[model samples]
Target: MKRRNSIWMIILVVLMTISLIGCGTTQSNLENKEAPKPTDKVTIGFSISTLNNPFFVTLKEGAEKAATEAGAELLVVDARDNTAKQISDIEDLIQKKVSVILINPTDSAAVVSAVESANKANIPVITVDRASNGGTVVSHIASDNVKGGSMAADYILKTLGNKGNLVELQGIAGTSAARDRGQGFHNVVDGKDGVKVVASQPADFDRAKGLKVMENILQGNKDIKAVFAHNDEMALGALSAIQAAGKSDIMVVGFDATDDAVKAVKEGKMAATVAQKPDLIGKTSLETALKVANGEKVDSSIPVELELVTK
Candidate 1:
């Protein structure tokens, strides 16, 4: 009888052990099944040179739309055209611990330090509409400024019959857009003997400055037949100055086919304008930033398309 009891006890103990093990396994499975999954949302930082300009504003809108569509949070800061402020803004973004940073530099060279800082923090940088002169940039999203400039020059040359005294209203002095556009325009006009650039002045990419500078140029060079301003704002300003001076025969060309510039082209007030898709640029910049954040490869330079708009 005692031997029989021992056998039964052994069986009971074995059953209890198996039951405990099975219960532990089930609990672990339940715990794992109830656990939350890792999140895929990422935060992006966008630093713009200025929101004052309509082009930049449109660019910002596109970025916001892209961020929303990608399910990423976007933090935007405006530099207001101040390089120092832009650097500070970028530093602030670093502190926020953004996954990636997209910047439209106030000045290409001046923003290098900011980009380097981002690099040190291991945050990838993407540039839009303008490029940084220094630091590691994963991608640059912008229109082909050189080509657009050449197109503008070609239109001006064709309109003027390759013979005219022209004035160039330049954009910001150090920006890549200004430099490339100026180079491209000069490349064509400089070789032509009939076309003479009467005056080229930096209007700082501002309408008021463009008007004032153009007015000053007009006072000295009265026989100007055509004008090429780096951007539509400056072009419109030059147009205002030209109209004020009572000049009717001068053909004006501008870049950035903004709403006002397009209307001007339609109205036959301006001869031509370069159409850069700022919205596409902004959207692409954000998309590239997301790719960088997600450990994906991106092109160093992404050229957005440019078109020439004429009346």
Candidate 2:
């Protein structure tokens, strides 16, 4: 009986050990399960060439709205159309350790250094509405300026019947928008023998400067049939110059369908203007930047749609 009782005791001890071991194994399995990914917040940096223009203001608003929707913070810096200031602003963004950087360059060539600095820091850089001439950009978001420019040219040709003296009020000197738009316009006009570009000058994409330049051009080229300015601000300036000169027959075409430009078109004061979706450009750029920050693949060039606004 003693031996049998001893055997029973041994059996009970072994069963308890087995149960404890099973419990330990279960606890170990629970502890070894994969952890959920962190939900750390991210911040994006946006640098604009200038907020003075209504188009850029719209762009900024779109970016802000997108960042909010994506649960990210945005830090915006306005360069006020100054290249040096733009570079400085980018540097400040880099120092702040933003997850990504979005830039609308005042000068394409000048922004290259700022982009390079971001690249060295391993931060992705995205350009909006403008491109850098010599930097490593992850993506570029903009309308097809060349196409928009060509559309403007086509309108000018049709309006003038392929024969007329023309003046071009250009944008800033070193911007990709200015260069690409000018190229597209010239591609069409140069191919046609009837249209002659009598005067072409940079108004620095400013309304007041456009006015001054157009006034000077009018003094010399009184037979101008049409004026094509890079942006609506310049176009409005040219329109003022034309009105002051008593030239009611001259037609004006501008890019960027600003509210005033659209109103002008409706009022029969301007012939036509190209409509670029600034809000779309801004939103798309911010979204692309976020993707780039997350190690996702993005297209190097994203083209927004453009429309020619006419009366």
Candidate 3:
């Protein structure tokens, strides 16, 4: 609003800050009024289950970068892993007239009604890293979790020499990742004669629970040779429990190439971890959301490739 020598221009990015990149107009050459025109605040909603986990944190970073570059406002709400809260957050975003909605759901089935409500408000919805069993979300971007699970299984087989007792540390009990990863591991281990799953327990994707569950499993069966954890946090926690128990016979493998998991892999503490590339997942989701919001055709699902990192 103030045209001082420093040039103070007002841009109303309501919910979040926007960084404008002047590509078509040269700010140095054109007159102040004719130079880079500011874009109106186009608030896009992001409903994240929680900001506590590293994966979700990285996803938020990527989404923020994309939103800033596009001169769009980002309104992020935390559900704190509650389905009801997630639904309310979406409803609030819709009431605020956010241009689009990006949901990293707390529960696939529970979020269906919220997505439907957003749709009724003429707001496009996009799912990131998880899918709803119902509702018409415009686009979905998530890692090929089943394939990542297979990769971990392959690592376990190779590490255990294809014939050893194993344990599975599941993520959040009902999440898609936990189910798919379990299926992938079982498919491989069930076929092998001596490679039996001695224990399979749910850790709820938390390091503390992983430690506790692993501790219990260790007391019951000390002969386990390898463990496949559905997520990096769980795997790392299991690794710590193994160390605390003074056991060196267990081979630990984790999905999600989180920093801790990578360190463990490098130190030979964990056999391998799958790299999901959360930054890419976030960027792709927003770009896809933009397309869907503009009435352009976008794929229902874009699968993220997985990479195995092991030493």
Candidate 4:
């Protein structure tokens, strides 16, 4: 009876060991299932509004550099500033099942449906240099355009000595950057009793349009003392018109200190321009997208710093 009991006890110990080994395997599998490995491949999609502008070109380059550093694949599609094209590009990226998407919207309100499509696909979306009107976005990365606008206005005020007739050149009508910048400029300029806005028109952020608009405004308003363009392109266009008209006394303030704009500032052609870090915005957007892909939490609004560039 004692020998039989000893044999049974040994068998019982073997059974317990096997049971523990099975439990260990199950727990290991569960842990592996719960977490993704860091080495998992990541693919990011970029939908640019237009590469025609040098600013956007720089932004794309920055995103590409960041993607290369992270060992991630970047698929860039240019909308050429077409809202429909942008929406279609986003849908394509969704069908490609990219890990994340970065969009620079051509029109703030028009891109809502496209953004929603990305949401439905469970792909994270980040906006660079612009924002979408309605959609679930992980984060928005851009300069504080309103503040930059105010900065331009303040500079104009100081340059004009608190009293002048000003002309406002607007950007694309539906864009948030255009709206916010115009608001900021008006916020300060409107309240001043001495300064008056002679003419405000949308140049669609185009240099040629800015020139033509300024020429028309000049034809009607000869007393205009200064011009504030929503962007450097328009500002440069306005500058050309002013120069051709032999109006050397007019002060021009612009936003987005692009290379040409900065050169103009240095050469005393333009009064000042609000500097936006387009490269940083692009870099941050890609980095943030990677974090979101990794299931990390991020702020809904991310603002890049702005500076007033002057000669």
lDDT of each: 0.93, 0.93, 0.84, 0.93
Off by over 4 Å in 4: 1-39
- Candidate 2 lDDT tens digits, 1-311: 99999999999999999999999999999899887879667889999999999899999999999999999889999999998999999999999999999999999999999999999998899999989998788889999999999999999999789999999989999999999999999989995787799999999889999999999999998699999999999999999999999999999999999899999999999999999989989899888988987889999999999999998
Sliding window of 10 residues with minimal summed lDDT for model 4: 32-41
Clashes of each: 0, 0, 0, 0
Per TM-score, the best of the predicted structures is 1
Residue 83 local lDDT, model 3: 86
Candidate 4 local lDDT, 39-67, one digit each (tens):
67799999999988878888899889999
Return the TM-score for each candidate structure: 0.88, 0.87, 0.85, 0.87
Better of 2 and 3 by lDDT: 2
Candidate 4 global lDDT: 0.93
The C-alpha stretches of model 3 lying farther than 4 A from their native spots are 1-41
lDDT of 1 by residue, 54-145 (tens): 88999999999999999999999999999999999999999999999999988999999999999999999998888999999989999999
Across residues 51-133, which tens digit of lDDT does each residue of candidate 3 receive?
A: 87788888898998998998778888989888899999999999998889999887777889999998788898888887877
lDDT of 2: 0.93
- TM-score, predicted candidate 1 vs. hidden true structure: 0.88
lDDT of 3: 0.84
Candidate 3 Cα deviation (angstroms), residue 144 = 0.7
